[model samples]
Target: MSGPALPPDVIEIRGIRGFGRHGVFEHERADGQEFVVDVRLELDTRPAAASDDLADTVNYGVVAEQVHQAIESDPVDLIETLAQRIADLCLADRRVTATAVTIHKPSAPITVPFDDVVLTVQRRAGEST
Candidate 1:
């Protein structure tokens, strides 16, 4: 017989905005920029649903705060690094089997007119990449 079925549910947190001083250019870091983050967490919600308890599932409020903190503090030179940090934070919760983190810089330091620069990183429970 097969083991118990896992829930194929995803929790999406979108448009998390924060001020971050991250970039290659010195001025970019000095001036700082607005960063928006979106994350999709893959987890089994069956336990939470059955118990109807917040503890049985990942607390997204805490996750949002953690992601915002990652963006606002410990400025990095690359959005890749920042995205990885956010992924790591989300993966910290054992309930989350995988996570997709998207970082958007609307005010990128580009001479030409551009809408936005975005970087996304995906991480699984065990693998770093």
Candidate 2:
């Protein structure tokens, strides 16, 4: 017989907006633009659920703050780097087993009209940092 099943819990935060200086162009880097970040943390929620305690699970509030800080912290040439930074931050919490991060640039310097430019990345625990 199979043992007790592990809880598959995910905490998601979407559409987190912040101003950042990130891009290849000097103008883009000099002048910051709005960036939207989305994060998903996958973990077992059984402990938190069973104990009804916030300490047992990832605190999404803190996650949001960390993500925002990461975005506003430094200047990067690629959204991929930003996404990786966010993913690292999410994985910092021991409770999180994996995470996916998406970054959106709505005001990319493109002559052609487009909704947004986005990049998404996922990382799992025990993976290379």
Candidate 3:
């Protein structure tokens, strides 16, 4: 795949919720919790804008489903890994030059009170971290 000609427009998808059994503690893996994900894709939308066709751009609906599926399917230990998995999902589209994935674990097992726990990951095409 080639790089975008333009600086790349941002397509943001937020509040993607899913139930996942992901954590280090045994109870966390067994009981599970709701995970909220925010995905931002950097891509050139000019092609789709000009052609007025769905095929010319990334279909966010499909992307959301894929992310949701990944959350429900696998049991990973770290949110970092989960974020990377989501980033990989977004970068799967050739049109997406870069992606930012923010994973929110609201019901985390923290001793102290907190509003939320979040992990954000940034990835570019053809790179893994």
Candidate 4:
């Protein structure tokens, strides 16, 4: 067959925010905090596109659940770590060719009042390989 046609890969999930303790300060983990996550997944969906089957493509719902599970595991030292982990998970999906994971920490325990602390991480498939 001719070179596999480019797949239409698209995935976006927003809001799926959560409240938990993830920080370095002891008080942060003790009192807990809130966090928001926005994720986007990119991949070659040629198979799913042709088959029109969810099973043939990466599922955003499942991705969201996986992210939730990672953040809920326990308090993290830094948002960067969380971002990296989330990105890694996205890349784990065989169908996913690239991913962008952003973690928003509102009401961060900062001395000065700020809107929010956001961390964005982008990763592509086969990064480790």
Candidate 5:
């Protein structure tokens, strides 16, 4: 016999930008910077595909709003924390089985010139969700 089915559907949102005060440096916190966020949610889409009903699937628009709120809401010291928070928010929806969050800080307080600083966090349902 086959094992239990897995969540195979994926919803992705990328390059969500917002301004937030999140860092360890005094100036970093005082001078808020733009943050870019990306999120991916895994779930089962069969029901939605078959039913053709909005309620049967995860609404990406609502997910985007939630991600925006998480990014622009409170101030945290590290992007890791921010990523975790985003993951938690995504997993809050019972339809989602797993989620991955990537937070990018393009204008980080680093002397050396770099492209960007990014942190990615992934989580599954039933684990601190």
Candidate 6:
């Protein structure tokens, strides 16, 4: 008789926050700014779960490093661009089924100081064109 198939598994990473210089304003972009980023990654890991192999599933450390790199790598004109780029990067991995990205800017340049501004985006691997 054939052995039963392995059950599907999911690998998740959360609460990865960092400070970076990203904004539209000249000073904000020039001098740099602070940003908090949170990300969630969903993927299938039946192989890894059964085989106990790192290569069979997504790596949380790698994902976190990638998100961090994406945020600090290039100057973005808008947070929207930054968020979208992040989601796209996570989705690039065939193993990742979906990804959620949340970015918070607490020190946004404004006439009045505010608590914070948060932007969240969710994208599925196939749903996005």
Q: In model 3, which residue pairs have backbone atoms overlapping below 3 Å? A: none
lDDT of 1 by residue, 45-98 (tens): 989999999999999999999999999999999999999999999999988999
Give candidate 5 misplaced runs (Cα > 4 Å): 1-7
> What is candidate 6's lDDT per residue for 1-129, written digit by digit as tens?
989965435555665666577887888877876777887778776778799999987877888898888878787888888899899988888988788888888888877868998899988889854
Candidate 5 residue pairs that clash: none
List where candidate 2 sits over 4 angstroms from the true fold.
3-7
| Local accuracy of candidate 4 as per-residue lDDT tens digits, 74-109 | 677999988888899888878788888899988787
- Candidate 5 lDDT score at position 4: 96
Q: What is the lDDT of residue 41 in candidate 3?
A: 95
Q: Model 4: residues >4 Å from true position, as ranges?
A: 1-8
Model 3, residue 12: C-alpha shift (Å): 0.7
Q: Candidate 3, which segments miss by more than 4 Å at Cα?
A: 1-6
What would you estimate as the lDDT of candidate 4?
0.83
**Worst 10-residue stretch by lDDT in candidate 4?**
1-10
lDDT of 5 by residue, 1-129 (tens): 999976478999999888888898888789899999999999999999999999999999998988888878899999998899889888888999999899999999889989999888889899864
lDDT (0 to 1) per candidate:
0.93, 0.92, 0.93, 0.83, 0.90, 0.80
Alpha-carbon RMSD of each model = 2.1, 1.7, 3.6, 2.9, 1.8, 4.1
Query: Candidate 3 lDDT (Cα, whole model)?
Result: 0.93
Winner on lDDT between 1 and 6 is 1
Q: What lDDT score goes with residue 27 in model 6?
A: 88
